[model samples]
Target chain A: EDQVTQSPEALRLQEGESSSLNCSYTVSGLRGLFWYRQDPGKGPEFLFTLYSAGEEKEKERLKATLTKKESFLHITAPKPEDSATYLCAVQAPKDSNYQLIWGAGTKLIIKP
Target chain B: SAVISQKPSRDICQRGTSLTIQCQVDSQVTMMFWYRQQPGQSLTLIATANQGSEATYESGFVIDKFPISRPNLTFSTLTVSNMSPEDSSIYLCSVKVQLSTDTQYFGPGTRLTVL
Candidate 1:
């Protein structure tokens, strides 16, 4: 079975603090890993996509890195405005309809 | 990247009633999907809306309860039939532009509250 698990269900950090969220997965054949940021009452916004191990992508203060079995989303000097639920999803070879297996997501709070 | 829009950002409806959510894209997309999200939970795929064909539903979902329509390449609709309190959730629409890639862009979801 292909599944995705995100750790640290919720995190509280002071402004300017940095942390990394983990997204571990078990899939037969990994096609791609995606990261998204969703705010309250809004849809998720695309952040990054990591296709292979040792691959990384960055946007503003966020960086996403991928491995064989997991992916990490690192936040640098996060501000209060950066607080949101971070979602992780993966595409596997078995999903012929282009469906993605999703994780529960990590709720991040940046207290000023 | 594609721009997507969903109608009726939030609504309050009585149980046994139904609500139809519309999703429109700025450009023609190859794939469109509907998802349901409970508060503080992960997204669950409801179905895939295919243009000019019947929508493909997921394992736990059915067409009768959640009918979908894809009239063209850039527009689709998802109707929640005989909605119940358990159906109170955020229904989202997403689109994938390219088949070779796996990035999906989402629209501002419709927040449904059933009484």
Candidate 2:
């Protein structure tokens, strides 16, 4: 079965602190890995999509990198406004439609 | 990037009542999906709203309970039927515009509270 697991269910970081959240997965024929940011009372916002190992994408202070069996979302000098739940989803090989296996998400708190 | 919107941002309903959530997209998307997020839980996909066809439901979700409608490419609806307290959740609508292979843009979810 295809599954995604995100570690460190919750993290508390001081302002300007940098850390990396992990998303490990086990799938048969990985198609793509996605990262999303969800604020309270709001749906998830798209962050990055990593298709292959050694691939990376960055947006502002958020950086996403992909490996064969895992992905990492690295936050650089995160601000309080950057605090949100980071979600990880994996798309495995499917014959008909695109289905995503998601992680529970990492709740990040940036204390000023 | 695509813009998606959902109606009735938040609502409180009595048990046994039903609620329907609407999702509209600025542009036509190939795939639209409905998801549910229980309090403090992750998003669980309920169904895939396929245009001009029957919506495909995921396991543990029934068409009789979470019926979906995709009359066109730019709009869809999801109805939560025979609601119970356990059915209270944030219902989200998402769209994939084929910008690439992945990446689903989501709308501000509808917060449902059942009493």
Off-target runs (Cα >4 Å) in candidate 1 are A95-98
lDDT tens readout by residue for model 1, A44-81: 99999999999999999999999999999999999999
Give the lDDT of residue A108 in candidate 2. 99
CA shift of B64, model 2, Å: 1.1
Write out the backbone clash pairs for model 1: none
Residue runs of model 2 more than 4 Å from their true location after superposition = none
At residue A109, give the lDDT of candidate 1. Answer: 97
Give candidates' CA RMSD values in order: 1.0, 1.1
Per-prediction DockQ scores?
0.94, 0.91
True contacts kept of 1: 0.94
User: On a 0 to 1 DockQ scale, where is model 2?
Assistant: 0.91
Predicted structure with the largest DockQ when compared to the true one? 1
> Which of the numbered candidates is closest to the native, going by highest lDDT?
1
Writing each residue's lDDT as its tens digit, candidate 2 over B32-79 gives: 999999988899999888798899888899999998989999999999
Q: List, residue by residue over A1-112, the lDDT tens digit for candidate 2.
A: 7889998999999999999999999998888999999999999999999999999999999999999999999999999999999999999876665679999999999999
Judge candidate 1 against the unseen true structure and give its global Cα lDDT, from 0 to 1. 0.93
